[model samples]
Target: MRIYNTRTRAKEDFESRLAGKVGIYACGPTVYNHIHIGNARTFLNFDMIRRYLAFAGYDVTFVQNITDVDDKIISQAKQEYGDELASGAMSPEEATQLVAQKYTDAFERAMSDLRMLPIEPPGAYAPRATEHIDGMIEMIALLIERGYAYEVGGDVYFEVRTFGDYGKLSGRSLDDMRAGERVVVDERKRDPMDFALWKSAKPGEPSWESPWGRGRPGWHIECSVMSAKYLGDSFDIHGGASDLIFPHHENEVAQSEAATGIRPFARIWMHAGLLNVNKEKMAKSLGNFTLLKDVLTQGYDANTIRMLMLGTHYRKPLDFSDSALDEARAKVERFANCFRDAEWAVRTADVSEPSEVSELARACDECETEFRAEMDDDFNTAGALGAIFELVAALNVLLKEKAGALPDADAADVRHAATVIEELAGVLGLKIRSNAKETAAHAGEQGRAALRLPDGSAIAPDEDSMSSLRDSATALGLTVEREEDLVLAVLDKRAEARAARDWAASDAIRDSLREAGLAVEDTPQGQRVTPILSSPRDLAHGSS
Candidate 1:
């Protein structure tokens, strides 16, 4: 495996410091408010990389730190929970806790919605900065003892001049940094580049008992401490957005290495490229900030959003646009529909000579090989997707030649191909929706015989409506058949299983139906059946 190391500014071979194990720490969101699309992109990119690493047989211990205690969190908390005007009713400590939990919960939910790795045990562990305050204090104390940091008036600051490799990660020297410096520096600092290691708590703000008096850990100190506590003083990979390459990540390197005397704190420093809206950088001040919910409103599922994000290389800025999302949707639909066709051919094809090798089986082998090769080459998801699309095209060709059916051996080959597609796509966090043919059949039949949308919008089509839908399908070279009705019947049975507390039975039924190319979603009202569309759009539209 190869990953582009931000520290080296080059693509290098990836080798875990510990054999067969990868310890990865990504700078997580500061729980201040709802995360925007830029945050989503950074999180999703690392997630995909993490998934791929696990797929390659590494025991990955992924750690993402939640910056619960930060200047931004404190300010936002005051604005949100404090009383109007000068101060809030709640104290800074109380407000910080409230804001932290609110946005932390929201961030976790967004991760789940994006289908990223789980945040609990047996998945990625998200360590909160508050929980690791002791660790930060200990690290800061170590740095101070090593003559790398100093204390001043209940505050501690890192001495930038003491660290010989201060700007190595960002490839900036003290001279280059000074030339473009903009922020005002504290008069007490030994140097203008010196950054705070611990901040003295102001009145009504959150604070912890430390050697530097009652204060909270500085922004960079929290990450260094938390990452070392969880992933050790040195780990395999440390990742974040490209924007963090400068001050944030550079400061981390200085603090961690100064405390531990390690040459390199993390082996590979991976930073995902920033996200842009159209051609401009997405920012609140620019009035073009996009949230995940906003994209969902455009009829895109989390899967589609993820697919769209992964379409661009991880190190390249992606310009978010509706047209780009539409293209991703189309690609997802193509893969889903192709897999559905392959399954049908496998189920209906006659048994043939088992000894003979099938062309489709060979193609499946090629697809798997190609997919792995592409992924191994610095996790080129774009190249891997291209391989999947080629397999889809091949399967379509086979189905057309066989008149939608194949011999028994050929059917098995088709199934193998479909399974390979599903497995590979799953690694990319792309859920291949079932019942593509049905979804296609009902593509333009929206609101006809519709029960309800995922958002609670109702659609009831009577006899005339059904007739009109059928006419529209015919005109569009589609067929409205009993497949949908059969799907509903299966969903009804699955719902019964759920009602009876037969979770195993219900899950099995859902998987069985999905393999057969039908998407069965159990909504709060009842089971809603739809043609398997790639987008997990809510069923309220009857086209999810």
Candidate 2:
């Protein structure tokens, strides 16, 4: 397999240190708040990589750390407690832990909601940085002993100059670098680039006892220590968002190798590209920064989100917008319908075998071949997804011509086609057949609209047709928070208007909703409320 190594800045052949085992450590969230979409992109990419590696027949050991103690966590605690903390209502450590655990739970819930692969046998794979404080201290002590790190005034720093290969990963000469962001122009530092290994404890913050007194591990040190503990000092892959290529990962490279006396601490350095909204960096200050929970609770499908993300290569910038989600919804439905129809074709098989059956079997084989080729080339999820869709397209043709029931031999082809899609989708962690009945029903309902409300609930399509479309949408697996009530209230009013033969009132409600990016259509079965890609707030504004 070939992987794009961020450290080497080139796509290179990937070989596991052990014959059939691959160990990977992907940098995880800081848990200061609910993880935003940008953070989600990095995590999902790594999860995809891990899943693909396992699919490639390697025994993959994936470890991701939860940074429970951080500067941001402390700041959030101070902001939350304000005067209560000054009055000793709660200690800083208590507040820090509270924030950490709360957000950590939220992160876990979001990952489940997104259907990310849980690092199986979860213990060694998912470690909290706080739980590994001793490990960090031990690594820091080793770095100091090796003259790569030094302690001064209760704080320890990694001497950037001592390690001749310090800038090798980032390709920056020592003199050309500036340490303004994480490093300050401390008079005691031998050079401007010297970074803290252990930070001295400050007021209203969490601290631990180390060789250098009461202090906390630096941002970069925790990852180095955690990765080493779980995946050994040398492992197969190290991955995170591309933005971390600089001082964060570079310092990790320097300290991890310097302390262990090992070369190439991580063999393959994979970094997922950053996400953008309207070509601008997605930041909270920009107000366009979306939370994964927000998107999920707003009625977006998990597969739809994954479909939109995996449609792009991991190393390419992804643009996220409502319209993009709308487009991705169609592709997700197509996949869903293929699975549903293929199953239907298999169940109701004809007695006659057609010449097309052999062709379809061949197509399924070709799809798998193409999928592996794309994935083997730097984890090209976009191309791999295309390969699966091509197979789905071929299956759709067979299903269409057979009038939903293929001949006996072709029925086998139908099953083969569906299994191929499902297995390949699993490699991308797309969660196919996760809810088969719902998958088919969702595809049948043509549901593009989802309501977001205060409580996570969905809108029943309409009162009169509620039994039909509501069940169909629920089967489709669109999510929301308290949106069901508002959705029902408005659609219920329109339903009442229609029941009373009040055309004007019904048209008015439908028109307002249409303006809000919702399409209220009357199908042969019933009224269908579909989203046209606008957010729930937009719907509310239009209705008001």
Candidate 3:
């Protein structure tokens, strides 16, 4: 697999320091507030990368750090709570921890809703910045001994000039950086380009005792220390948003390598592009940032958001708009419906014969091959998803034209195609199955709910209500069937049932629904039940 390395600014073949094993350290959230979609995008992209690597049979160890202490946290605590400790209230540390936990929970929920599959469970081995202060102090001590860092007042700053290859990652010369500098110059620094390694603690701020008096680790040092402590001195990949390419990532390279003498801090440096809103950067100051929960409230599925992110190359900037999300939702529905239909057909058809199966198997193999090829090409998810849609379209066409002629082997082929599509989509952490079923179930519910008694008899729902329900359900990945006067919710319940080995209960539910004038169909998305007719008695008695 080839990955674009920010250090080299080119796509290079992946070569793990250990054979067949990949270690990744991704910069995680600061936990001062709930992470917005832009921040979530970075984690999602790296999650996909890690998933894909493991899918390709490589052993992957992914480590993402939690930045528990930062200037933002300090500022937020003071402004919102009015110095909790000073008022004989909670301490700064206590206040920050409370807010951090709230946002961390929100972030984890967002990731779960988006169906992100971590190589390791969430927070499986996550190292918090505050927890690794010892590691930071040790590294700082080494840097000081080597003359790479110096103490100014109570603070320690890395001398950029001492690192001969300071500008390698960002490709910015020291002179250019100095020329464009806007922040007030600190005369204590040996060079204008030098950045903080450790900041001396201020009065009433969260502080830890260190050799250089009471202080906290700098932003860059937190990552270096946490990564080294958890993933070792060097790892396979170090990922973050594109904005960090400068001082954040560059400084990390300097401090890490200078302390350990490693040629490269990370073997691969993957940077995810920013998510733009209305041609402007998404930031709190801009007042244009959209929270993940707010976006979900606007009726876009979590999967649709994931699809929107994956629709663009990870390295390319993507513009966020309602229309873009709508497009993504539509695309997800199209593929999901196709998968569901194929699955339903496979289950209902008689597989007593084997003729024509070989041809279907060949087609399935071709589709899988195409899907893998697109994914292998730098995770061109857009192209890979296109390939999946193409296969879905082909399967739909085959079913429409040759439903009866499809051999039992052909059913196997269709199943294989669906499996391959789902597996590849999983690498990107997109749950195609949920999108298909949830939409259908919701639509079916709304359709049933809209039914009203006319002259004491049930009738079909109004077009407007049906349309609205369909749109909502389709966006949610559901299929709807309208009977004379009844709507039945259909979904795939077999997977859960089978996992628990409740075969009898699963089959009974299918039979019971069928007896109630509902046809139960199981698909990749889930189980779907369509009502054959509306029953006044059933509606009144809540029997169906």
Off by over 4 Å in 1: 84-89, 349-356, 434-528, 531-544
Better of 1 and 2 by lDDT: 2
Q: What is the TM-score of each predicted model, taking all chains together?
A: 0.81, 0.80, 0.79
Clashing pairs in 1: 82-88, 83-88, 83-89, 350-408, 435-517, 452-540, 453-540, 453-541, 454-539, 454-540
**Between candidates 1 and 3, the lDDT winner:** 1
lDDT values for all models:
0.76, 0.78, 0.73
- Model 3's alpha-carbon lDDT is 0.73
RMSD to truth, every model: 9.5, 8.0, 10.4
Q: Point out the higher-scoring one by TM-score: 1 or 3.
A: 1
Stretches of model 2 off by over 4 angstroms after superposition = 120-124, 179-183, 285-287, 350-357, 434-544
User: For candidate 1, lDDT tens digit of each residue in 51-115?
Assistant: 99999999999899899988788888777866732455566777789889988877886676577
Ranking by lDDT: 2, 1, 3
Q: What lDDT tens digits, residue by residue, belong to model 3 across residues 1-544? A: 6788888888888788899888888888888876777887888888888787888888888888888888888777777677566786887777777767766666665666566663345333567788888989999999999999999888999999999989889999999888876757789988878888888888657888889999888989988887887678888889999999888999999999999998788988989999899877787777888777556534465668878999999888889887787788788888778777777777865544433445555566676787678778787778877777777777788777666666666776677767766776777776676533231112232234333221121223345544543454354345656533333332233345556888875676566445544456664544544434332234323554
Order of models, best TM-score first: 1, 2, 3
Model 2, residue 439: what's the lDDT?
15
Residues 1-544, candidate 2, lDDT per residue (tens digit)?
9998877889999889999999999999998888888889899999898888888898888899899988899999999877778999999999989889888877886786677887656522888989999988999999888888889999898998888898788778876686335556679887878888899998878899987889888899989998988889899999998888888999999999999989899998988888899998786667879888767645566787888889899989999888887687778778888897777666656524334448888898899999999999999999999999999999889888988445688787778788889989888877666432121112112333334321232332333343343443353343423433445556666778788999987887787666544567774434666554445346324666
